[model samples]
Target: MDTSFVKTPQIQQLLDKAAGLQESGGNPRLKAIVRDLTEALMALIVRHDISESEFWLAMKFLGEGAGEIGLIVPGSGLEHFLDLYMDAKDAEAGRSGGTPRTIEGPLYVADAPLVEGNADLSSDPDPDAQVLHMTGTVTGPEGEPVGDAIVHVWHANSKGWYSHFDPTGEQTPFNNRRRIKLAPDGRYAFHSRMPSGYSVPPGGATDQLMQALGRHGSRPAHVHFFIEAPGYRTLTTQINFGDDPFAADDFAFGTREGLLPVPSRQGDSAYIAFDFQLQRAATAAEQGFSARSRAEAG
Candidate 1:
C-alpha cells in the first residue's frame, strides 16, 4: 500500500503511522494524548495547506523560543481558556460565590515575604510613586471568614518592570511581592505603590509573533494574587486598574469585569477595596495548595 501524500486518502495512513511508531505499555494516558495530538496536527496541516517549509519553520521557532513559551500562553489566550474551563466546571459543580479567577502570568516567583496581617508590600519604594492601600477580606461561600489563609500578591514597579524578571540589582528575590496571612477575622491589608502598565520585552519571540499578527503585547496596570485556605479551592487572580486606558484591551485577554478594581483616593495615597469569596474544595487535592506552598513542597 503506497502511503504517498499525493491525495487526501494518504492522510489517515500517515497519521496512523506517526501515532503507532511509539511503544506503549508505559503511561496509557500519555499515549492517548499523543495520538489525539497527532490527529489534530494532521487535520490542521491539511485544512490550512501548511507546506513542508512552513512546518519546519514553526518547529524552528518553537526550538528557539522554548524558554519563553510559558509566557506566550497567556498572551495567546490559552491561560484564559483554562480559567474559563475551570469556571465552567465550578458552575457545573454548584461551586459559586467566589471572586472570579484570572490568568497567572509568567512573572510569578516563589517564596515571597510572609507578612503579618496588614503590612506594606512596597519594599524599597520609589520616591515619586503614589502609594496604594489595598484591603480585602477572604470569605467562604457560606459567608464565613477564612482565617490563616495565605494571600499572596505581586505587581510591576513604577516603570512597569517586575523585580526578578527585570534583574533588579537587589539582594532580595521578591520586589513588590508579599504574602500576608489573613487576620483572625479573615481580613488582610497591604500598602504598596500603584503599578504601571507593562509590555512584553521587545525583540523576543512573543513580540515577534505579536507583530506578525498586528497586535501589541501590552498589559494594563494590575496586581496579581494567589489566595488559598485550608478548605477552599485556590484562587489565582488579578485586580485591574479600572481607569487605565488599556484596562479593557489587555493583550493577555485577562481583564474580566469582576476583576477590575474601582479607583479611589484619600490624602496622598490611593485605596481599593475588593473582597474575595472562595468556594469549598470539592476534593482533598484541591485544598490548601498555593503557589508558594507548592513550590516549597517541591
Candidate 2:
C-alpha cells in the first residue's frame, strides 16, 4: 500500500496558495489554469519523489535552453498535440476536408524575398547539391482554385542547416527561403536544392532532455509552408520527403499523411508536384497567419 502527500488536504491548500487561489486581483481564467497546472505538477513531483537537486538541475536546463524551447515543445509532441486538438475542434465545428496542420518547427524567418508565380528559394547555390524543382497549386474543398494565395516556403540546405540560425556562418541570409505570391490561378513553382534531415544541437537543452528520455531529436527532410488566401483559413503545414529515412520516425512528430511526396529523379535534378487544399474561413480572425512571434530578417 502507498499514499501520496499531494492528495492530502495540507498539500491541496499549498497548491491553492501557490496557484493564486486566494488572490482577489488576478485574472480568473489565468488563475484557474495556473491552479490546475500547479496541482498536477505537484502531484507529479510527489509521485516521482523528485529530489531537490534534480529539480534545480531541470530548472537550470530550462534557463540555459530557453532559446531551444521551441524545438523542445515540438520534439516533446506538445505542438503535435496542439494540432490534433485544433483538428478535433474544427471537426466538432463542422469543418472538414482541408490539408492537415503540423508543427511549424522553429526555423522560419519572416520577410523572405517575395516573387510572383515561379521563384527560386536558393539565392546562393551549392556545387555539391542536387537541383530540385517543385510545383503546386492551392485550391478549395470543392476543387476550385484559391487565387492570389501566398505560398511561403522554406527548407534547410543540403548540409541540414538553416540560415540565420546556422552557427557555421556559411549560409547566406534567407538561404533557401522564399515567399511566392501565386498568380490568379493559385499555382506556384520553385527551384531549389533538396534539403537534408537535421538533428538537434548536440548536447544542447533539447538534446539533453531527449537523451535522458531515450529519444532522438532529428527531423526529416521537409519544406515548410504557410498558405494564406483572402477567404480561406491560413494553413501552417509542411511536406516531408517520403524517401527520407526519418520521414516515419520524425522526432518532432511532424510527419502527416498526404504531406509526404516522393520526388522523381531526372539526371541531376528531382521534381515534386504537390497541391494544397484549404477550407474556407468561417471567421475573419482565421484569415491571417497566427500572431505567434517569429524571427525576421531586416
Candidate 3:
C-alpha cells in the first residue's frame, strides 16, 4: 500500500551519479540528455505505477526506435541532413551560385555503360512510348565549361521497375541506364524512353509500415543522376518528368523547382535540356578527387 518508498533519496543519488558519469567530457549535449532522461524516468515512476516487465518493454522499444533512426538515416530524410550541413558550410565559405545539391536515393548502381554522344537507354519494345533526348551542359560557377565531367544516369524502365531491384525479371541489363562524359564545351546528351510511375513494393516491410500509417508509397517518374568532376562538389540529384501525375507530390520529398525538367513533345521525340552549374573546389586537397572516390573512402 505504501509505494512512496520507491522515490527515495538513494534513488535520486544513484541518478545523480549516473548523470555525473555522462557529464565527464564525453559530450556536453549528451550530459544534458542524461539529466533529462533521468528526470523523465523518475516522473513516470511517480505517475504510473510501472511494473518491472513494463520497464523492460520500454527499454526494448527504445532500442528498436534507435534502429529505426538508422534506417531513416540511410534510406530517407537523414541523407538530406548532410546536404543541408554542406550547404551551410558552403554559405560560410562565401561559395554562392551553383545548381542546388540533392540527396542520392538508395537505388543508384555504379559502373554503368559509358556511351558516346547520345544513345537509346530504354529496353522496352513499345512503339507508343515517346523517346526522350536529354541534353545538358555542365559548367563551373564562373560560367566556364567543365570538360570530361562524368554523368551517371539511371531510371526505372517503362513499367517503373529498376534493373537490379525488380523481382519480375522485366529489366534487362542496364535497361534505362547509361554513363556519359561531357564534351569540350561541357555538353552531354542521351536518349531514353519515358518511365511510368511506380509504387513501393507491395507487402514488403516498407509497404507494411506505410499501410499501418495510412500513407501512400508512390514515387513520381524520375531519373537519377550522379554527376562528378575533378574539382567540383559532387551532385546527387533526381530530375522529374514534367507530366508525371505524382511529379508535384513525390513521396520522397526530393523534388525541387529547379530540378524538374521540361518535357517537350515534337513529332516522335521528347527533349529536356538544363545547364548544371557546379561550385568550385574550395581546397587544394579536394582538387584531385572525385565524389565516388570520397564516398568509397567514407
Q: Quick one: best TM-score, which candidate?
A: 2
Q: What would the per-residue lDDT of candidate 1 be over residues 1-298, giving only the tens digit for each residue?
A: 2223434557665655556645554666766677678777766777778899999999998898876776688888898898889889878977667889888887777788898967888777576678988887899988899996999999988889877776556524577888898877999899888789988878888898899889999999999998988878888889999989999899998899798886696667789999999888877778754332122211
Ranked candidates, highest lDDT first: 2, 1, 3
Weakest ten-residue segment in model 2 by summed lDDT: 1-10
The regions of model 2 sitting more than 4 angstroms off are 1-4
Minimal lDDT window, size 10, model 1: 289-298
| lDDT tens readout by residue for model 2, 1-298 | 1237777899789877877889888888988898888878777777788889988998898899999988999988999999999999998988899888998888899899888857888977777778889997889999998878888899999989999988998989998998898887888899898788999999899999999999998888999999988989999999999999999999999999988999997888999999899989999989987777799886
Poorly placed runs, candidate 1 (over 4 Å): 1-17, 20-24, 168-171, 288-298
| Greater-TM-score candidate between 1 and 2 | 2
lDDT of 3 by residue, 1-298 (tens): 2345545788766766777763456766776689678877777776787888989876775565452432233334566677788779878988777787766665666667787777667765646667878888899988989997888888886677877766887666777877887787988888888776787767654454557667766778888887788878667777887677888876666677788876888988888988888777766555443353211101
Model 3 lDDT-worst window of ten: 289-298
RMSD of each: 3.5, 1.6, 6.3
